[model samples]
Target: MKTDSQLQQDVMAELRWEPAVHATQIGVEVEDGVVTLAGEVSSHVEKWNAERAAQRVNGIRGLAVELEVKLGALDKRTDVDIAQSARNILSWTGSLPEDAVKVLVEQGWLTLSGEVEWQFQREDAAESLRSLPGLTGVSNQIGIKPSPSATVVKAEIEATLRRSAAADAKAIGVEVHGTSVTLTGAVHSWAERDSATRSAWGSPGVRKVIDKMSLVY
Candidate 1:
């Protein structure tokens, strides 16, 4: 196990290594394995990248982001412009069904709400808008169209876990209730926990994934 100081240093170093993040503008603080990131970033993409860089470090139990996005003068745009850009991008995205997702913009924040057949489509809609200039934040309310029975969902998640190299299938427990899946167990690292959760979301009918898994570090 790494000490809190060592963990903080590693996270800072990882932030520096990520090209998309401005490491000097971010502050990393670790306490009992939980990392808190505080600072201001120029873009929402930079803020997102900073968080991902911190999560890549080992021995992290939890993460709290206090970073704020402060758009530069050149990056700022009107809400109408932002909304038009979001619509154009969503329409051009081949992974999403035509007109399946609706977009709303308020004060530079974009909100997407609709239904999609797969979780990846829902994620792709939001991810494609992250780098948009003048965008402050995104609210991804796109829901999954439920399919498959509970038994099949559970079995597919278990099979995915077993096949994933990052996760230990035996160490995790899966429970399915309708379209919702609950994961309960202990994972050795954040990567394993993320892998297991992603597997649960990949199931055909899964709508919500409740992660009750703890990181052992």
Candidate 2:
């Protein structure tokens, strides 16, 4: 069995390689298989990233997560604040109906799950969650499909891409079901692909953008 320090070091190593964690700080203390993370991060997303990073490394009794959040931004949130804000955002957003959605917070990270009407609701849910205090990241594992007009949804997605992407929204094919948009085809680079997705996400009614775009290596 690895010593606490050894396991902690391994966990840190894992976080260093993770693709998601940025714009924050992390500290660790280990005793036996128990791991505790300390320090202040900019967003709940980063905090969640740090914790998930620790879990992905393995060899731990449990996570004793002690993380502080930077105030003002939509990331740092207390448990009560997230619970209230979640209720508020979902109530206003009209994407996910009430009672169907749920939000859970641990150390400021907001975990969301439920059924929603539009794909954009899923994305909006993430955005709403991302803005709450102490929200490190949102686990948007929501399902879509309320069986509305698919054509109108696709047109809305295209219009949204036109407003946000600004480069080649016409070329970008959008398949929308409720609020979800699946973008298939090729783009110039990763940045462009992300930009396209951002456009879709920016739209008020859009929920999720499955960017299955390819780039030439």
Candidate 3:
């Protein structure tokens, strides 16, 4: 286990190492393995990058982001412009179905809502718009259309975990309730936890994934 001060230092160092993030603009505070990030960032992408960089550090039990996005003069745009840009970008994205996702913008924040057949498509829709100028944040309300039985979804996720090198299949437990899958167990690292969740999302008809797995350092 790492002391709170050590964890904070490590997170700050990791933020500096990430090229996309402006390390100086962000403040990292750690208390009992929980990290709180507070400060201001120029763009939504930079803010997202900073969060990921902090998560890369070991011994983080939880994270709370208080960072605010303040767009520069050159990056600022009206809500209409942001919405149009979001629509155009989504249209050009080959992975997403045409008009499958609806975009609404308010005060530079973009919200996407609709239904897609696969989890990847839902994710791709939101990712495609993260780089839009003047965007403060994104709310991905897109849902997945369920198609498989709960038993089959559970089986597929278990098989995927077993096949993945990053995750320990035997140590993880999978449970399915309707279209939602719950993962409970202990993972060796953040990478393993991500792998386990990804495996669950890969199964067809999985609308939601609940991660109850703990990271064991």
> Candidate 3 — which pairs collide?
none
lDDT tens digits, residue span 25-123, model 3: 999998889999999999999999998998888789999999999988998999999998899999999998888999999999999999999999988
Model 1, stretches more than 4 Å misplaced?
Answer: none
Provide TM-scores for the models: 0.97, 0.46, 0.98
How good is model 1 by TM-score? 0.97
Question: Candidate 1: minimum summed lDDT over ten consecutive residues — where?
Answer: 145-154
lDDT tens per residue, model 1, 15-55: 99999999999998888888999999999899899989998
lDDT of 1 at 179: 93
Query: Which candidate tops TM-score?
Result: 3
Total clashing pairs for each candidate: 0, 22, 0
Better of 1 and 2 by lDDT: 1
| Overall local distance difference test of candidate 3 | 0.92
* Colliding residue pairs in candidate 1: none
What Cα-based lDDT does every candidate model obtain? 0.92, 0.68, 0.92
The candidate that wins on lDDT is 1
- Model 3: how far is 52 from its true place, Å? 0.7
lDDT of 2 by residue, 1-217 (tens): 5678888788888878877765237788888677888988776666777777887654566578788666565434478877888888778876666777787777665678887655566767777666565565567787654443668667665776677643467667777766677887766544566678776665445556687765432
